[model samples]
Target: MIVISDLRIAILGLGYVGLPLGLALSRHFRVFGYDSNPIRLRELRQNVDSTSETSSYTLEHSKITFLEDIKDAQDCNVFIVTVPTPIDSNNIPDLSALCAACRDIGSVLSSGDIVVFESTVYPGVTENICGPELESSSGLQCGSGFFLGYSPERINPGDRSHTVETVCKVVAGQTKGVTELLERIYGTALSAGVHVAPNIRTAEAAKVIENAQRDVNIAFINEVAMIFKNMDIDTGDVLAAARTKWNFLDFEPGLVGGHCIGVDPYYLAFGAQQAGHEPDVILAGRRINDAVASFVVDQIANMLRPSSRILVLGLTFKENVSDLRNSKVAELVTLLTQKGFQVSIHDPRAARLQAKAFYGIDLAEDLDESYSFDAVIGAVGHKEYRALDSSKLLRMVKNDGVIADLKGIWRAYDFPPPIRYWRL
Candidate 1:
């Protein structure tokens, strides 16, 4: 067995997950962070993470070296792959990014080296899909020439409480030596400790279902939200009463966006189908969650006049993150635009250039100080929008304008007058 302290680590895909983990691990090893995106690399080099997961102070001070070229990781003995696992247009799991990472990493693989995947994928993907790709690309024997491991990333963008260092790490490896190596490596860096899964596939399954389970729970709340609406009752009021009892799950009803919750369920369902088992409940949750944006739009349209101008606050998938990928707000904007309603969107945390590039959304600039519209929708519950006084919120909308509170952040506040509020 190789000495844990003697290991050289190369982290592939320096996004929301890998970057933080790399920074944390750098304190204990010779960490080399690599990403295919040169633009992201340039930003990281300047200590500016567009992802907002890392601070400039940490980025500048961390001893970890960031790299753009794949050849730079040749000397590293441990490779951690934390790339995104996205779903295609048909909602099928796309492994192009993960496969490409394996091919690149395989080119640099050496004997006794272990490639650990942190990306969220269905069970057997790391062992069956990635292991073969690595062997084929590197011309090496699996578990003989180089080994494999799985450590599913548990990163929640915009979440300050359960950070990479604070959350528990689940890791599994092909061999006992490899598993112990990971336990010591991650356990040394993180205060939350690490769990050794029985095997690599078990770790993968654990990560995939973590997000899928949340998706199912949220779907139930959303379905009931729609049901309560038909009964002329507010879901928030019902939830407030229901939450009085202990053990009541506190999942809110809202648009399920972002990479993990929206995309991971399909991976699980796909794996289930491959095993010849029908995954009806998983698919049902996805269907309900996916329909949330359209349902929100329909409710908004019903309350407003045709061709009414609506100013949407917060465009990111969640509060306090710059990521706009798979954001349901863009879908809401598109649906409203198609319905002949003029929609102007704004998000304090989202990258403007990326938003325009990704969704062609010309985000309304600097609407915080002064802006007025026929209606104002709190699409994302960002802190800035959350802290807005009731008078300020009144100023954002017309006297008879409706306030669509998606996350119910403002449900407790009493607006000045004539400003109606609605939330799921």
Candidate 2:
């Protein structure tokens, strides 16, 4: 019997999700945090988290041992895999990282050990795909020799309110004993408590739908935003009036891109197709959300000259963070460039190297007061962009330039007669 007292945890992938989780769990168990990137390990050792999810003070005070080599965590019996499960170029579920983590854990998996997955995936991935992979690499029976568990992670990057310790956790296991074990382990660490799922597949389904539902809701708002644009109405004003209803879901429209909401719906759609069902609504939502960048490009292009010199603000996936995975701003920039506009991008929050590496976007070092553009586009609503008042905006744009606020950040600002303002 694997007792709660004997739990030695190994956390794989120390990025956004794993870093915070490893720090929280280290308080309750002996945690060995491992990431494939040696540079990430070195940064963490010096109390630096590039993801900005965890602070330097927290890293310096944590007792968890960080490791670059997965082999160093061989003694850990409880392995929690928090690696990313992103979609490939074809929008198919890429289980490369998940499978590789399973193989790594299997090499060190001992009898009666438990392997829990916190990465978002389709319903059958934990049992149908990962189980066989673990069995093949470990040479052990899944249920009897080693156990499998699923607990979907709910960490929201750049959101400090809902964290691993504060949010309710959903967990499941292959057997009743294993389920109870996970409940005890997670229950002790999280003050928000745990919801024990009937089975592993049920837990997986719950996680995927959480983000898929958001995708559909945002798609509805995005479609509405475009319709309002054609009608010469402001989407922000319409939403402001509609929000008087107490139960109205306040979902703003913008480009949907990130690790979860932008990617998880594809996993659900793929699983539905594999089970002989066509997910029409789910797919329609994805298509609508994907086309938002193009719609934005077309709207802005119509207002400016063909040879207009434009400036784009912010490049990260969302406001106030350094995470650039699956960012829709890159697509928007590409479309603007394809339209023959001379575009220069500036993001105060995004790393210069990552901006260039991920999207071939060379971020401008600084927004010089003297240099002006024919048009200024507010793509991402970072705090720095939000603080740009009317005077600062006037200094950046030419006399007859356009200010396209895609995120409604400057909707209330009153620009001069010469500066034309547009938003969706």
lDDT by residue (1-424, candidate 2, tens digit) is 6888888999999988899989999998899999988899999999999998888999999999997787888888889999989999999999999999999999988898899999999999998989999999999999999999999999788888988999999999999999999999999988999999999999999999999999999999999999998898889999999999999889999999988899999999999999999999999999999999999999999989898999999899899988888899999999999999999999988999999899999898899843589999998999899998989998899989999998999988999888899887
Q: Any runs in candidate 1 off by more than 4 Å, and if so which? A: 368-370
Local distance difference test values of all predictions, in order = 0.91, 0.92
Candidate 1, 1-424: lDDT as tens digits:
5687678999999999999999999988999999999998999999998888888998889999987898999999999999989999999999999999999998999888999999999999999999999999999999999999999989787888899999999999999999999999999999999999999989999999999999999999999999999999999989999999999999999989999999999999999999899899999999999999999999989999999989999888888888898999999999999999998888878888999999999877788644678788898989998898887888888898999999998998887556778888
* lDDT of prediction 2: 0.92
Model 1 steric clash total: 0
RMSD of each: 1.2, 1.2
TM-score to native of every candidate shown: 0.98, 0.98
Candidate 2: where are CA atoms >4 Å away? none
